[model samples]
Target: MTTYVINLDLPGAVQSRHLYGHFAEHLGRCIYGGFWVGEDSDIPNERGIRSDVVEALRALNIPNLRWPGGCFADEYHWKDGIGPREQRPRMVNTHWGNVEENNHFGTHEFMDLVELLGTDAYVNGNVGSGTVREMSEWVEYLTRDGDSPMVRLRKENGREQPWKVPYWGIGNEAWGCGGNMTAQAYADLARQYATFLRDHGDNKLYRIAAGANVDDFGWTEALMKSVGCVGCNSSGVASPYQAISLHYYTMSAEWENKGKATVFTDDEYYATMANAWHINTLLKRHTTIMDHYDPCKTIGLVLDEWGTWWQVEEGTNPGFLYQQNTMRDALVASVHFDIFGKYADRLFMANIAQTVNVLQAMILTDPDTGALVLTPTYHVFEMNTAHHDAHVLDVVAKDAPVSRKIGDKKLPALSASASTKDNSALISLSNLDLDHARTITLDLRGREVTGVTARILTAPDVRDHNTPDAPDAVAPREWTEISRVDGGLQVELPAHSYVTVSLDLA
Candidate 1:
């Protein structure tokens, strides 16, 4: 039996809603067929943006969206994506598939999508292949008001009023595709570029410097030393960039053989879970370095890119990064969110890589039939949406069962996190054991619970997933096997399950 003692009186930092944010890059079908079907296409759409995808994502209460590239951002020239769609230049997407990119879904299209979804924008600018003036003008073009050169260009391109861009990324992976620069070299360039990313009108940009790849603590240290804090301002905030980013993807196997998304053995599953658990360590180590420099914790850490990276579906474009999402993916997401909730103070925002029809996508779209299927990972996001911006509740698990063993390490069978908001609290738990169900006791403290409702996301097999023909193969269903206990509540968590319990506290 696993017992979780949640202290209701002791609430921690408000989990930033942005932590549930998503990423949309110009990769594979994520952009073209997934989100955009063109205004004239047969698919039901609003001004060229697919309405189904919009409606589906809106259900997640998506807070923000990062756009226009992973490696493509560094190479993408903003000018080519503006003006008339017909006249917009056609360029080869050198990084992704070497496919020709007809500049149809550019700045205007993206902002329109943002408007439709009612989400904030996190735009990554070009720093590797683009000039300072180009990056500055792109920011000015989207956000600047009144009559400036960039503003006039924006108006000429059919948008008279300026758009609100709250978050802006300096570059993507500076240590890799964004430019093979050393940490110090990238840090110097970040400072210079950040200087020109001005706050025009009432819009103040939250500039995010492209941070480390995975465990490159030296890169994080360099950015902190060079650009994190130059001097304190009147308000005591002293970072050139408001936040720094980190990108880490969970691969069940090695880079060359990133195990199949839907097919894997128990050993592979345990290995993947172990890899997912490693992010907690990475966060702790990075936070230690960050705490040393800005003891005040003014600057934020944006885990802008993260998710499972499996091999491309066979016969699909390898560069497209298309893969199926399954019960395993949902557990991975649950684990990540649990960790994200723990580090809410320093980790302000996180965007899962490629929201639709790409790596660990929420929704998969069929190119031939125009069919859309929500992935298992999508349900986890919907179930845990209550934690967005809610106060974190301290949950201590005692005598948690060991799920399995990976090498010498004994992996825990359960993962849990709690948060409170308004007059209610949410408890999310994941049972990683593959064979047996575990009974859990919720030892609620400091508050009187009036009512409880629960939902569980699980499938008979961990490999179960949704296809266009069967969209609900692995979806959430009402979980009613919960009973009132002396102190709190008791739940029967089935194997390979993700459960969320909502409590009405008085």
Candidate 2:
């Protein structure tokens, strides 16, 4: 096979902090059992939130977390989830499953979870089911420090002071579940709702308007221009919405016929990857529209919710939306990190659908068994965390082919890139072809490498996955040097694999 190489000499711009953000919704087992399981559970936890899960997230160096809902955000009422847990009303989760939401993991629990993760909180407000007063009061309840009813209520409920929450989503998927309003109508509603969200002294809440879904640049353009009109006036202060949110889910199967999580034909796997690669286009097209309106990159594009959506496992509740993470999922995660790293400038914040037990969740929970297992995607994130906040070095590899029934798609068996932090260089590479392993040669170009360590996440087969009994089926393995050529290093990458090469520069 032809070897692909990344010349670290020609590196792109450094990465932005937004690339490290994550999303956590109330869907499936993501919030309740995965992250917050009530203090009564036998599992290791802190105030209902899982301690191990929090530690795992903390280890990923998670930057920010968007919360409340996906479709749930639309119908979510902030009041029902605050104050005391017992007094907090129980509502049906009309979005995810018809399961009852007992208000156990409310605003306090969420903000507290973010605190434990050592990340900033991005709360998605209810523009669909809530009013201006309700949304604004939520801000006061969590952010206001002065003497006020909201603050007093907050203290009486337990939290004496306020938590500084900066990013606030005015709505979520407003074009759909948020209200199903036209761009013009949603823009007007956003104006009214945003007007009431007070900054509350020290906390500068970036009121992010619920933005476009996928290629709907019209929504972004209209909202940005209309909101820019509102923001430009009144002393020409910066816009109330510091960002605009967008959501996209890449699915290989149709809505009803979503493909299997692990058992997939080679054709299905390639098509799935093709769908994931479309993210590059989504970012480019959305950013182009935003650039036309705000050239200086004033407003950010928040892919608040994104990940692979597959059919629910057999015998599992359809509303649960849980699927096993396979090696293919790991490859998808790695490629996503590469795409987001490239677009770090325009992409402000994002969360990978969810953190656990939901669609493409990093952690899965079995409440019955009291078992918690990290998914393959979780290991991919952990491995690639080195790319966080590091410079994006330009990587170029000649296209390699992965043949499928449709046609010969450019597989690029060897995909590689470099990121530098301090004096260390982290090189991430992937071998895309499932059946063919490739020997990749890296031209270090004269950069002295004092030592090298390799970590790989792969499986004996592309379809290999982890169950509760086989959680470590596809985990990262420590590797030694394959070979050091005269001026470069040659590494053998397995078929359908993800690898991270760490170099300690002298």
Candidate 3:
């Protein structure tokens, strides 16, 4: 039996709900058909957003949403998507799929969707392809409170009040698609753009600079040093950026031959876990460097773009980036969320790559039928929402007996994290073993474990996924066997599964 002692007395960072955030990009059907069917369409929608998808997202209690682009963000011109839907000019989405993007789902539409979902907006500003005035005006247009030209234009466009977009990404992947500028160059440009990206009234913006793309320690160092505390306070004080953005995705190997989402060998599965574990390493090294530059810990690390990226589903546009999610994706997400919670102090926020109809998405909407199914990744998010706003508790546990080596790394069979709020505690665990059911023994650390509830998402087959017709084929089921035990609570975690147990502590 694997043993873990939950230390509820030690208070840790309050896990930001934004860590359970989602991403929506203009790629493929992510926006046009996935989220927007138009009010006129047969698909049930309010305004232009899909009602059912909104409901599903609401159920997950999504904290924040990053929109309009992934690579699309940099090339995106906010003007092209505003004004009148018909009068709003269409543009080619040169980034994802190169399809014709009708400006139907512009800034207003996105904010409306955000309001409907009741989540914060993390707007990825157009810095690469857009001019300083353009980025400045977009922020002004959405956030300016008074009757300025931009505000007047916004009132004319339909939105009278401003949206409190607390988080703003300076650029995305500036080292890559956002723009191939050297780190020093991007830093200079970031300062210029941020100077013009003003704040209006109570809608203070938390500017995020495009940070390193996974293990690029040099890029992180360069941005921190060169930017020298982006949006830094004058008088030689240091506030830098509220956060530095980081992007990483779980993958088996090269992009071209990255193992298929649902079809992979045992070695590939364990290897992917090792790769997922790399997030731990990256966070520590990056945080260490950030401490060196900004010791105050005012600067946070925003993992804005993260999730599994693999070959698009068969027959789908290669650029569309629609991949399948199964037990593998769920376990990967569990590990990532645990890490994010453990480092909530330095890790401010994170957003999964795509929320729907894209890589590691939550909902799969059938465009023709409008039927939807929640992916395994969706259930994982739903199960762990209790961690939001709860103080993370340090849990010491012995490694699972089964350890698989991928290259120089030994991937643990089980991963876990714990958090507490008031009289309740949330413990989430993932078992990566393919064939062994491991029993986890938890030491409640002297707290009264009055009530216990558990939810498990594990299928008979690790590759099992939900189709539009068979949505429950791989969904969560109540774990009925969880009960009070001597040391604490002992529960059976099925191999290759993710589980969340809520405890009512006295």
Candidate 4:
């Protein structure tokens, strides 16, 4: 048996609800058949967007969504996507498929999806293959309420009201697909582009500079120094963004041999998890770097791109980036979210790589039937939403004695995080043991835990995943393995599971 202490008296960073953010890109079926099926399709859609996908996203109560492109954003010309659907120009998605791209689902459709999901919008601007005037005008089109040419053109296109977009990324991966610029080079471009990126009306933009690839502390240092768009002035006055971005993915150490998503040995699982735990080191190093530049921690770390990146599904387009979401993905997400919650003060926001039909998606769609099935990762996010906006509770847990390793690496057999709100508390727990269940005694030192309820996501096999034909094959089940006893709660956590326990604080 393992024991843990939840010190209710000691408060941690307030878990930013935006930490549960999602990303949507224009690659593969993510836009066309994934989330957008024209009004004529039988899959039940709202003005073109798939109804089922919309409902699933709404259920998660997502706080924010990033749009346009991953690498596609840089190559994407916003002007080419608007005006008239049929009149819109067709071009090749060179960054993604190198296939012909349609301009049907553009800016308006994305904002509509955000409105339908009741979430804020985080728009990434084009800085790689686009000019400064192009991105500046794009922001003007979406935000400006004045009677300018762009605003008038926007109203003429149909939307009478300007959409609110608080978050904006100056670019994506400037070190790589985003023009392959050097750290200093990208920093100079970020400042130039952000200079003309104006804030219209009350929609205050949170400009995020393209962040370091992974462990590129120099990029962080350079961006912090040059990104003078959000905070202060030439004289230093301050409303403050101080925000920069970061991107990380859980791969098999090598992308060429990413291993199978739904079929992996315990050895592969251990390696993947060890890589996920590597985020802790990245955060510590990056934040340490941030402290040097902005000691007060005013600058936020935006993990805009994350989640598992496995090989493409069999027979799927390689450029499409379609992959299966398995039990391992659910575990990885829980661990990442736990880390994000712990550093919520500086880690203001994060978005999983791709939302649907893409890397580690919450929902998977079938092309033939247009069917939608929630993945194990979906259930984990669905169950963990209670911790949104709650202050994290400082927890100290005893690790399970059993240890699992792959090659030269090993990870804690158990992981957990806790948070509390007004009269409510949420505790998310994960058991990384490939086999063998662990009994845990949770001692809430100074708070009463009542009205306890839990939903656990686990399966008979760690690789078990849901297909369109078996959508319910692996879903959350009401967990009755918990019971209150005096000052503590006893929990029998199933192996390879992610459980979120909700308790009414008294």
Candidate 5:
């Protein structure tokens, strides 16, 4: 094997907190039967959430989770979701399946879920079909300590204390199901709604304005300049927008009557990986403009919603967005995470499209069998968790091939990043070439290497996936023989794989 070695001695570390983790929406199996099954299901649960699912997420060391949204946040009325379960109103989830939301999983339920997982809560407000009063009251209900109308209502509804929800989105996809507003129109509404949603003091709420769909720099530029001109204290001193939201999904086949899923040729796979890798470019473009306007890093690039977009399973409910999670998906996820790790400075947060039963879900469920399966992508998150909260170590790869196409192009076969956290050195590598496995020799140089261990996420076949029948098909495996040679390390990474090498300093 002709091995390649990455030298981490020269480059400084890259930030990892913004690899910020994922989300769960009120769509398809994600809500009703995916994450929440009420307090009475036979499956092992902690206050109604499946124990296995919770354990899977915890393993990922997930830092933050955005709740009750996508386009759903716009139509959601927080008040309708609280109070007595039976008395709480049932509303049709207009964005997902047009199914009745049983009010079973409401504010307290979601907050309880996040707390159980030991992750932060990023709540999205209802701006499309909800009022300023509704938005403000929800914030007060969650963050307020004093006995206000909303606080008293929360106590009456069974929760007496407050949950420190730090991140709040003004709207979700305002140009689409969020509100169907023009770029300028959404910015105006976001400013209006953000004015009333007050922070209750424990934590400064990171109020995020709804951003564009794809590469709409116009939306970002207009919103930032417009908000800046209005002055920082225009709508209360706490009203400054901390992050601007953006959403993107990588779909291999883009025509989209229903993009092909699961069954794909090599070209399709390559195209998908290429497109997924474009996140680096998108982040650069968006961040460049934000830097020009507010260069001090005051405003963050919140990739609030993102993940793989594929066709729904044929026999299943179309709106459920059920699809297979193959090793290819895992490879795509690996590259995306590396990109996020590189841009950790500018990118403050990101949430995968969902946690379960939605686009690129980390977990999948079969309610009838009560089966819970972790996808390959889930394994990637779990492996990369060590990078979280660890200050980023900057590094670069030389002689890596950059894939350029007629319309869209991307970088070469190798992606690498290093970080030193908790007194240990962690190095992550992504070998992007779909056909050939790579033998890399990492030169740690002066850094002493002891107790070297690696977690490799790869499958015998690129098409290998996790199914309800075989949940652990593509799970991670440990490789300790990846050598320490004369102040250097030799590792063999399979084709299109993600590898993480952990070393304890001698």
Candidate 6:
């Protein structure tokens, strides 16, 4: 039996709603068919944007949406996406599938999508192949008010009022796809670009510099030296960039061959879980380095791109990055969120890569029939939504199951986290054991007796997933095994399951 001693009175950092954010790039069906299907399409839509996808994502309480590109952001020219759709120039998406982009879903369309979803915007700027004037004008075009060249252009295009853009990324991945520049070189460029990304009117931009690839401490250190504030007086001004980003993806195997999405053996499954656990180390090390530069923890850490990366489905466009999401993916998400809750103080925001129909997507859309199916990973987010903007509760596990060895690393059989808001509290648990069910004791402290309700997401097999015909094949259902105990509560967590218990506090 595993015992989780949760300290309800000792509340830590507030879990920022942006921490549960999502990402969508111009890749595969994520944009063209998944979110936008043209205003005239037969599918129910609101001015070219898919209504079903928006409604489904709205249920998750999506706080923010990052647009334009991952790699495509660096090469994207904002001008091509503006003005009339018929007159907008067509460009080949060199980073994606070599498919020609008609520029129909440009800046205005993305802003409209953000408005409809009632979420904030995190737009990535072009730096690798774009000029300084272009980025400056784009910011001016979207945020500035009163008389200005960019403002006039924005009005000429269509919109008369300026849109609010709170968060802006200086560039995507500068060390690799964005540009093959060295750490120092990219840091210099980041500083220059951040200078021109001005705050117009009442809108102040939270500039995020392109940070390190996984475990690239040198890159992080260099970025800190350039943008981080160290040993400064209290009178000193804040850093030009408010946060630095880090990108890490969980994979079952090597980058060259990242195994399959849904077809894998037990060894591969353990390997994937082991990989997911590695993010803790990455966060700790990066936070330590950031602490050295900015001891106050004023600047934030943004994990802007992260999720499972598996090989593309056979017979599909390899560059499209379309893969299946299974129970394994759901477990991976649960573990990530558990860790994110632990580091909420420094970790301000995180966006899972490609929210729909691409790479660990929440929803998959069929091209032929226009059918939409929610993936198992989607249920994990929906189950854990209560953690958003809630205060983190310290949970210590005792007498937990012994870790299993996978290759050189040990994969823990359990993952958990808890948070509280108003008079209610939420506890999320994931049992990674593939065979036997584990009984868990919740030793609640610093609070009186309360009512508890729980729901669980699980399937008979770890490979179980949802198809358009069977969307609820692996969905959440009411969990009734939970009961009040001596000091708190006790529940049985099945093998490879994700559970969330909601408490009505006294």
Give the whole-model CA lDDT for all candidates, comma-separated. 0.92, 0.80, 0.86, 0.86, 0.79, 0.92
Off by over 4 Å in 3: 227-236, 398-402
For each candidate, what TM-score against the reference?
A: 0.98, 0.93, 0.97, 0.96, 0.94, 0.98
Model 3, residue 82: C-alpha shift (Å): 1.3
Candidates, ranked, TM-score = 6, 1, 3, 4, 5, 2
Model 5 regions more than 4 Å off: 1-18, 229-239, 255-258, 400-407
User: Candidate 2, after superposition: displacement of residue 361 in Å?
Assistant: 1.0
**Candidate 3 Cα deviation (angstroms), residue 148:** 0.8
Put down candidate 4 lDDT per residue, 455-496, tens digits, no spaces.
888999989999978898789989999988767889899989
Off by over 4 Å in 4: 227-235, 238-241, 398-408
User: How would you encode candidate 5's per-residue C-alpha lDDT over 4-75 as one tens digit per residue?
Assistant: 344434434456464656888888888778888878888889889888888878887788888888888888
Question: Judged by TM-score, which candidate is best?
Answer: 6
Q: Model 1 over residues 1-506: C-alpha lDDT tens digits? A: 88889988788999999999999989989999989999999999999999999999999999999999889999999999998899999999989999999989999999999999999998999999998899999989999889999999999989999999999999999999999999999999998999999998999999999999899999999989874444454555467788889999998877888899988998899888888888898999998888888777877999999999999999999889999999999999999999998889899999998799999999999999999999999999999899999999988976645666676555678999999998899999999888889899999999999999999999999999999889999999999999999999999999999999999999
Model 2, runs deviating above 4 Å: 1-11, 227-237, 398-412
Give model 5's clash tally.
14
Q: Candidate 3 has what TM-score?
A: 0.97
Per-residue lDDT for 224-267 in model 6, tens only?
98855743656687687889999999999889989899899988
Candidate 4: worst-modelled 10 consecutive residues by lDDT:
227-236
- Model 4 residue pairs with clashes: 242-299
Give the distance in Å from residue 506's predicted Cα in candidate 4 to where it truly belongs: 1.6
lDDT of 2 at 503: 85
On a 0 to 1 TM-score scale, where does candidate 2 land against the true structure?
Answer: 0.93
